[model samples]
Target: MNVYAKNILRFVVIVFLQVLILNRITLHWFPEPAGALFIPAIYPLFILLLPFETPVWVLLLSGFTLGVTIDSFMTTAGMHACATIFMAYLRTNVLNALMPRNLSEYINQQPSIKTMGWMPFLVYSGFLLLIHHLVFFSVESWSAASIGSLLLKIAASFVTSMAFILVYILLFTRQNVARA
Candidate 1:
């Protein structure tokens, strides 16, 4: 399949999964008054997995579109857009740092555990997801007074989101289990 077709499919599928299923799941380990409130989000994986050659403008646009889509569904009032766009803005720097060489060196490759190796791919995705969650939770709370609550929300949401992301890779990828 073509990259555009595949990405479009990813966009639809991830958005559906997020809006229909993941959004309905509200996780809390403690009482509402004590701990953080969040849901596990895997939608950010769409932005993370785009082809290496994708331009920054496309990333920004895609991120905005995706975030706006989710916000429209959740009625979060552009909170998701703000977080996703920030993450999109940082994607290039994160990829460049985690990548061994310039993105040009990899013609047809997109990021995955297969291409970037386990550690680098994890760091790349993890860092970005953390940024996304941090911005999202911080914006949701919109306060610096409760640093503990903000950190708890970020960490909890990040871990939850990453778990769902791993399941997504395990279920969806073609060579995820096969050795090259």
Candidate 2:
């Protein structure tokens, strides 16, 4: 019920969905010869939902731990770790730019459509997800050999991840809509 306990539970649930469920499904938008596909990752939503007051050190540490956990399960070496950490690093800046007030004003609140409204929240999460996907795909291929293919993979994965994250917000974050 408390924030810490809630976050801990969220961490477990997101990772469970990512590792056991989403990881099992792969999306292929391109033909077989191109071999461009995507595996949507909703785990970044954990970091996105963390409280505004969480320290940078804590963010980095959490990102590393979360990424390492996924890496261990999915066995992609350290690709997830690398991408998550990078997303964590840029999270604050993205929030600052999108938010009208200082993050300190939002100490008691987590970023969500209810708190920040849909556009800002989506932009914040979308930008970080983009960073995560870019870093992840880049590290996976470890080369720019197929620039088109890489971009396609990133785009496909980003879109899928965003859709999943939106569904998650709608289902779990809760909304209080009042008709005026």
Candidate 3:
């Protein structure tokens, strides 16, 4: 399939999985911090998987669309939109900072375990995940009284999201390797 077709498919699939399946999974039983803390949002993986050559405006628009879709389903206006835009905006900087100096030729490729190496890919995904989750949860609980609980919620969500993203990469990234 062509790149545009592939991206469309990926966007649909990730959004469906996120809203229909993964969003329903509760990592914890009680709502100590909040009931929403356990929902693992893997949809950001779509943003992460975008081709590196994708323009900044395109990335931001895609991120905004993706986030708005999630927000529509989850009934949290602008939360996902803001977080996803943050990730998309910072994606290039993270990629440039983590990737090696001589690897500019790979700039147009989609990020995956096979192309970027497991460690670098994880670090890249983890950092973005942390940022997204931090912003997301903070926005969700935008009260000074809940700052400490928000921090904990962000940390927990980050760990769970990283684990999910790592597992996803391990399972799906090999296709890119085989093609390469």
Candidate 4:
């Protein structure tokens, strides 16, 4: 399938999975005071999978759209949108730092474990997930929750989200698909 068609499919699938399935999950390891640890989010996987050559404007718009879609369902105000846009804004810089010196080679490709290799792709995904979670949890806990709570939320959410994203890529993404 073409990149556009493939990304469209990914967009729908990731959103649905996130809203219908993942959003309902609330992991808790601590007692009453510390209640739910975090919510595992996989929606950002869509933003991360956009074509490497996608422009910054498109990235920001798409990220906002995706986040808003999730927000409408998840009822988190604009938290998701804000976090997603922040991550989208930093995507190019993160990619450039993680990628090899030869830019032309990866221009038309998607950032994936296959194309970028395991280590670089892992680092790229980790960085984005951390940033995304930091923004998300930080905003959610802004005034109401304590700094410790915010840090715990960020840590838990990041690990859970990263786990889901890695598994999704390993199991579903066409790792061996032709690269640019």
Best by lDDT: 1
Q: What overall lDDT goes with each candidate model? A: 0.90, 0.90, 0.84, 0.85
Q: Candidate 2's residue-wise lDDT over 6-117, tens digit each?
A: 9999999999999999999988877874656568899999999999978899999999999999999989988999999999999989988998888888877999888888
lDDT of 1 by residue, 20-86 (tens): 9999999986677657567899999999999887899999999999999999999998999999999
lDDT of 1: 0.90
What are the runs in model 3 whose C-alpha is more than 4 Å off?
Answer: 29-37, 101-104, 175-180
Instruction: Provide TM-scores for the models.
Output: 0.95, 0.95, 0.89, 0.91
Give the clashing pairs for model 3.
none
TM-score ranking, best first: 2, 1, 4, 3
Return the clash pairs for model 2, or none. Answer: none
**What's model 2's lDDT at 15?**
97
Residue lDDT tens for model 3, 1-180: 789999999999889988998988878534764534479889999999998778789999999999999999999998999999999999988988987763346755788877788789888999998889988877877787967667777777788777787777677654644555
For candidate 4, give the lDDT of residue 123: 88
The lDDT of model 4 is 0.85
At residue 150, give the lDDT of candidate 3. Answer: 72
List CA RMSD, all candidates. 1.7, 1.5, 2.7, 2.9
Candidate 4, residues 19-115: lDDT per residue as tens digits?
8888778786566455455678999889898988888899999999999999999889899999999999999889888886644466668888778
As a whole number from 0 to 100, the lDDT of residue 35 in candidate 4 is 46
* Winner on lDDT (2 vs 4): 2
Q: Report the alpha-carbon TM-score of model 1 versus the true structure.
A: 0.95
